[model samples]
Target chain A: MLVYIYDGSFPGLLTAIYESYYRREKPEEILAQDQWQHTLFAQEVVIKTDEKKADKVYQAIKDKISGFAARNAYCVFLAEVPGAEMLIYNYLSRGWKLGAKLDFHLADEAVLQVHTVAKKVRQEAHRMLGLVRFRLLKHELYYAQIEPDHNILQMISPHFARRMADQNWIIHDVKRGLAAVYNQVEWVLTPLERPKTISLDETGLFYESLWQKYFSSIAIKSRKNLRLQRSFLPKRYWKHLVEMDESRSRFAESSVLSPQSPVKTYK
Target chain B: MELLEKLEILANAAKYDVSCSSSGSTRKNKAGGLGNSYASGICHSWSEDGRCISLLKILLTNYCIYNCAYCVNRSSNDIPRAYFTPDEVAKLTVNFYRRNYIEGLFLSSAVITSPNHTMELLTETVRKLRNIHNFNGYIHLKAIPGADLELIKEAGSLVDRMSVNIELPSASGLKLLAPQKKQDLIIRPMDYIKLQIYEHKEERKISRKVSHFVPAGQTTQLIVGATPDTDLNILQLSEKIYKNYELKRVYYSAYVPVSEHPKLPQISQPPLLREHRLYQADWLLRFYGFRAEELLNESQPNFDLELDPKTNWALRNLHLFPVEINRADYETLLRVPGIGVKSAQRIIRARQVRAVTFDNLKKFGVVMKRAQFFITCRGKYGGQISLENKLLRQYLIAKPKPIQHSSPYEQLSLFNESVPSIPSEVMLSNLTGEL
Candidate 1:
């Protein structure tokens, strides 16, 4: 089986797709050279990183499988899963033959793996849709930060761009250090090396107080099942939730108000 | 105060009302807004019991004058109560919206001072959020049952959606459970809101102007298992509400045994599976073109808890089975067991250019295990079944007999029974003829 290798990049993966299609002889495995180590009885082919080849391969997949499938497959590659290259290679070759019908039940191992990876990426995309909390910056740019499990920077960009088309926004993936920026008409992604910083308006504290008060008021005291709440939403993610901010200030004030009684209530 | 303490009192009160969803609305923020509504609503985080804490589903106050037996916040229950001011609510919404912790507000309250007094407070809060605070986000306001029509109308104008819960399915149930509330009190406000929405829509067509009606439409909640009401009775009420009021949705909240009450059922947990079946039945009524009478009647009060509503219906009506996959219409295809909207749509689209075989049906996402007995593709059947037998009806809908060993005493003792009993083979022999 011929093993195809490319630099660990989305474009480079597209270049590998170009080589696999150009050579009519299909291989048993496709491995990235960086991830590939010495293996016995394996025929290796190094694919030169070419933009034109990558674009051609990308266009072919879009025309053949589906535009959605092409994008999803590219994202599955970004997940950096072990044996993702071979999975993509098998998926593409079979996808061309099966058309849109390839998504349903099948016996092929590669097809199964691709389906699992696609589902995982899709799940992450959905989570980010709800979790990407945007904080308004002083510069009128709606800025948000998230640390998602997958590289879902590009997956959620179009949704916000279309929905918030009138406003300027930036959603930075803290873990991946990438950002999706929308300026009126369209959106673009770049390495988030220098994000636009903003000063906290004095009204920020006021808003926080109001939110903490509301959160406290709305919560049902009788149904305060902490075990159940913690089970559904872990305390680990509580730092990002703004309603929990009052506890810090409440701690600072509790010493002055109570000399002996325990600070039982937060906010 | 401990947020936990407040949450316990308020949520326990709110939990009984049973309308905790941020879905079924399609509202976007206008210009100069910080947040927008998602078509398929956003669930920011899930609560401990796996409930979606999407919106801050809470009440303005737990103090009510009405005596509703099912409600923990009923005037009869001497519990500690709290209320949030209009400014407090608006401020809360803005902060929560900014943090992406909530989509908007689901503000419900008991009739604190009076119907008008509570309605005014609720409307004031929503108005402040929209006009004073410039907060344009999704808001679902609960209309007080006996509130003045004008106040309810004002609330409808301010919020995206409004719900007046029909807690009991029957007027008799209401009389027994909540003597203070009347059927007309709940249904009238809903009727007024419905008419106002229509009136606004009709006026907007003539002039290039927009009136903020209840843009997301109105919904109501029905508390299940609280009273001796059948599924047929409940669904009949739902059908009436849907047809007459033009409701966007009817939320069915399975009754949870919160307090040790003599009137309520002694259920250990909420009949969630039954509620799930009702939701499935509701979907069938809304989307699948099934009537309420077809699924339930006076004789069969409860849904078949063992089987899903669609599958149960399909099994009972065996004559409709073995439908031709390639030729059946969309509605006909929807009637097939185990076929959801997505699967049916996939089949219809995939079979447009080519004939479908059993193998091809698998590719179209048909659940082969369940669909195998129900569909034929290219004159080929996958399961062995006699289609013409009159006894198939008996085979399909027969309820499984409870095993003698399954008794509570037997379960607790965990001891072998020496009593005379029907043998396994004998039981199978008896059931096989019925099947």
Candidate 2:
């Protein structure tokens, strides 16, 4: 059995795909260097990433197959699921043969597998778009920490860059030690660690309190369904969400006047 | 009032309005702007009640002039009243948006002085958010029913979506519950917004430079179980509203009994099951191509408590069953009980490459338990027994639970019990006898 191994990068995977065709040998497994396990009887080939070769494969996928197929390959690479490298290789191998009709062949197991994995990656990115909660830092830098299931920092940053064009923000993916940092102009993905001893300014605390109050007050007590809430915003994501912090009891008294309290009528 | 206190009161007041969707508007962020609108709306959080908190839904004020029996903010009620200035609302929206806590603002209001006065305040809040704050986020403004057309039009152009709640399903219900609100007064703004949206679409076709007017289109809410309106009445009214106004959505909020009025029904819990059924039937009307008359007639005024509207329809119309999976058209496949829009489309796409066997149906996301009775794979029936309506319904009726008074609010677990397993072979012999 022939096993192909490459560094765990999108370009590295693409370069490996290009080499497979140039070498004219179908490997039993395509794996990242870290994920490859040695087998006593298997032959191993290490593929170094070449930008030129990677670009050829990417452009061919776009020009020959379709832009959608190219996007699916990129998203599946970002998914980082086990055996994802082999899945994308198999998917693209068929894509080269069938051209644009590859995705339409949903009956094909490899084609269906590629579409499903890509969809899951895209869905996670879209979910993270809403789940991210930014906190105001001292220097007016907005910082949000997320521990998403997938490596979606690059996928969702373009959305925030467009939405928060006037502000500087950093979306830190705590799980992957990656961050998409934006400075009112453009964004760049870089390795970042969880900041130690993070502090919130006075207004930051004030707005956080206000948001927590709004979140709890917005829920109707009679219709409370924690099960349904968990289904949408899972408990796993509750760690970073400001509104979901259990330490800050939503029912804690902040004022003498409750929501049910009668106030002086304004007529 | 402190901002926190005001939000607590106002958000609690606005929780009854169930239209929290921030979708269908593609408002892009301008240069140096603080935010943009997502075409498919994002839910920042899910509240304890399981509803998506997409936008920061709040009322400008809870102070009112006219007393509506169903409204918590009605003048006769003694709830705490508070109002946010236009600037304060805009500032709150920008701050929350900056923190990525909400998609945008869903600004509603009670009639503080008059409908026109309240409309002006709502309009001013959105205008401040758009122009002064340079915030291009999704904004859904509630259109005051009796407000002037010019005021409504101006507000519509500024916001992503606008809505005027129909309040009650029937005209008599409106008269009984909210006497000051006439039927025509409630509908006039809706008509005007509909006309303006249609006109804006035509204008955009001619020139791309034309600005959007209610770009997400208008939606409205009808309070269920507040009056004696039947499921038929509600569905028929929704059909008319969809046809006449061309609304993007019609939200059906189960009447949460807030105020105890002599005219109101003395129900302890909100009729959530009924509301769920209405939403299911409404989905059929909108997406599944089912008509109101087809789902419910004069003989059946209410939806079946055990079966969903689609399953119920399929059971009643048994002649259309055992549809050939490979040959059935998309519309015919959609009529199957368990085949939804996504799975039906999947089946169509899958069949283009290879014939879909019954074993392959599950992979395509088709629920075989209910669909087994209705669909065929290569002229072979999947159901164990013959396709008799009575026998099929016996297998299909959802487990009977306490319908009205359940407190934990469990979603109806449909088809929980396993059906008789499909036999391994010899199904073609009974294929002719089954149907």
- Structural similarity to truth (TM-score) of each candidate: 0.76, 0.91
Stretches of candidate 1 above 4 Å error? Answer: A19-30, A38-43, A56-66, A82-119, A132-149, A157-267, B1-8, B205-208, B259-268, B353-369, B384-435
Give the lDDT of residue A195 in candidate 1: 37
Instruction: Report how far off residue A131 is in candidate 1 (Å).
Output: 3.4
DockQ of 2: 0.63
CAPRI docking class of candidate 1: incorrect
lDDT of 2 by residue, B237-273 (tens): 9999999999999999999999999999999999999
What 10-residue stretch in candidate 1 chain B is worst by lDDT?
A: B407-416
Please, what are the lDDT tens digits per residue for candidate 2 over residues A58-150? Answer: 999999899999999899988888888889999999998988878777778899899899999999899889989898876787888888887
* Residue B188 CA displacement from its true place in model 2, Å: 0.6
How far residue B253's Cα lies from its native spot in candidate 2, in Å, is: 0.7
